[model samples]
Target: MVFWLVAVGCLFVGEASSSDNKITAKSIRVVMDNNYPPYAFLDAKGNLQGILIDQWRLWEQKTGIKAAISGIDWGEA
Candidate 1:
């Protein structure tokens, strides 16, 4: 009975330690101007595509996170 209890305790401790080593995904939100040219701008069809957007895409790909841009007037930003 003592051996069984020790074995169960060791198993629980190992599981707990493994769980502690697990990684968690980070949640992030970035707000940017989708109208600023060169840095960030909308395409002819009003799609967000620019230098900054490209950089953001690279960042998202590296970090395995989703990125998005919303259009807001200059004054609101």
Candidate 2:
């Protein structure tokens, strides 16, 4: 499900480290289809809102690593 996908994505993110095996990046960018309801989509105010969005926000709070989540068209994904 979406949870597993997000988990796997987080794993890959950690793999993008430097030669000393350290993650030098201060933030991470995540792009997904904006049309997927309940998982990812825009709200009435044109703001990103969904279960996945909330999850990422929580991840940011827990890890202190900013997650720049963006929603794009399915075709663009």
Candidate 3:
């Protein structure tokens, strides 16, 4: 009985380890106007830099989520 219990435990551990190896790609893309201020905009160097970017970076770090920013025209987006 003890040997059977040990074998079952081993099987469960093996299954758990294998299940943890699965990889999934999940991300969120954010589009905002490059001309807008505070909400979203680009800096002098032509990089997306603003309050929203800082907020999103913190959110991504805390939630383990990937994020990307793209420039869009105000009329289009």
Please state every model's RMSD to the true fold in angstroms: 7.7, 13.5, 7.6
lDDT of 1: 0.78
Off by over 4 Å in 3: 1-25
- The digit string of per-residue lDDT tens for model 2 on 1-77 reads 99999999988877765335756678999999998999998999999899999999999998888999989999998
**Predictions in order: lDDT:** 0.78, 0.89, 0.84
> Each candidate's TM vs. the true structure?
0.58, 0.69, 0.62
Clashing pairs in 2: none
Error of 2 at 27 (Å): 0.2
Best first by lDDT, ranked: 2, 3, 1
Off by over 4 Å in 1: 1-27
- The sequence of per-residue lDDT tens digits that candidate 1 reaches over residues 1-77 is 99999999999999988987744656466677778888888888988777888898899889887776565667787
Which residue pairs clash within candidate 3?
none
TM-score sort, best first: 2, 3, 1
